[model samples]
Target: MSEPVIWREPVVEEWIDYNGHLSEPYYVLVFGHATDAVMDAVGLGPAYRSEHDASLYTVEAHVRYLDEVSLGVDLEVRSSVIGVTGKLLWIWHEMYADGRLRATEEVLGVHVTGGSSSPLPDEVAAAARALLVEAPEEASGQIALRR
Candidate 1:
């Protein structure tokens, strides 16, 4: 089996917040790029979107911030395609820095064409299925408040 794809980016000064760490929005930004990387891997990237006028649209998402990320850190986001149907896809991302998991995100998206949900093309669907993996235990859960 081929190794899973990993996306990487360094945190920039502009991404830092007043708390002196990676900003919340930037975490989402990196996760979004990781999603794009998945699209590219599965043949649903920019070129395909332009040629076919179809793309993936996120329908729901959940993110957990587990640790602080400092500026200039090389962030690695390990992404997995946990599930896929005709039109729906589920992805999970684990963000790490200094070999520690700093955050995670889970997203649900739909293949869309002409502004409507549509089935993925045969080739793209097959490629996505090939990348399928079992969902991580930490993937889906609501945050609980500490009493």
Candidate 2:
């Protein structure tokens, strides 16, 4: 499988900081929202929370901001499953603008229920596993396109 575009939205006015670039926190926000889309795709969204009283909690995260994302441009988050465990999921996201690589975010998350760690529900686990993509044998982390 390949990375899928999990979420996208324009860089709006409010996301801009006094320096005229996307604010530090908004970078997290945009990537975090993309993670939510990954959860939702795996049947762990609002409906799952309503039915199972469970949700995934972000356990660790790392964001590398590579370039400036200008305002009013649409930012696309391409995501893929890195790995999965009995109770945790690992995901990666790459944010882009005008086809330029902008940022990369990786997160580790755990399923929680009743305030304690819980086994990931079957539906979500299956969906996530189906999307897993291993890095190519000779792949560079950055898939840059040159002119």
Candidate 3:
């Protein structure tokens, strides 16, 4: 299997929870940003949307929270394309904080245009396929978990 795409970010003060660790919701937000990066890489970003009047929409997500993340922590999310169909894309993300696996997010998304389902763009499909990887040991856990 190939290496998962690494999406990195620093935990700012605003991301901390009352317990002094990263908030639960922030985990999903960070992963959302990482997903945006993946979409951009696949030619489904803002420019593509502007030009084609189409965009990718998250259809479903199963987010698992495994550990805690503290403020000022550096986070790196390793994401991989689990699979893709004609109009759907499946993705997985493993989030790490201080080198510890802290969270995982699995998502299914669809391409849409004019308020209706649309075919995945060729460039987007090619990119997602190129980034596909075998599910890591971590991914074998529960398919869905609460934030």
lDDT of 1: 0.92
The collision pairs in model 3 are: none
lDDT of 3 by residue, 79-142 (tens): 8888888999888998998888999998889999988999997878988889887665655466
Tell me each candidate's TM-score.
Answer: 0.95, 0.89, 0.89
Which portions of model 2 miss their true places by more than 4 Å? 135-147
What TM-score, to 2 decimals, does candidate 1 have?
Answer: 0.95
- Model number with the top lDDT: 1
Candidate 3: which stretches are off by over 4 Å?
Answer: 136-147
Candidates ranked by lDDT, best first? 1, 3, 2
Clashes of 2: 0
lDDT value for model 3: 0.86
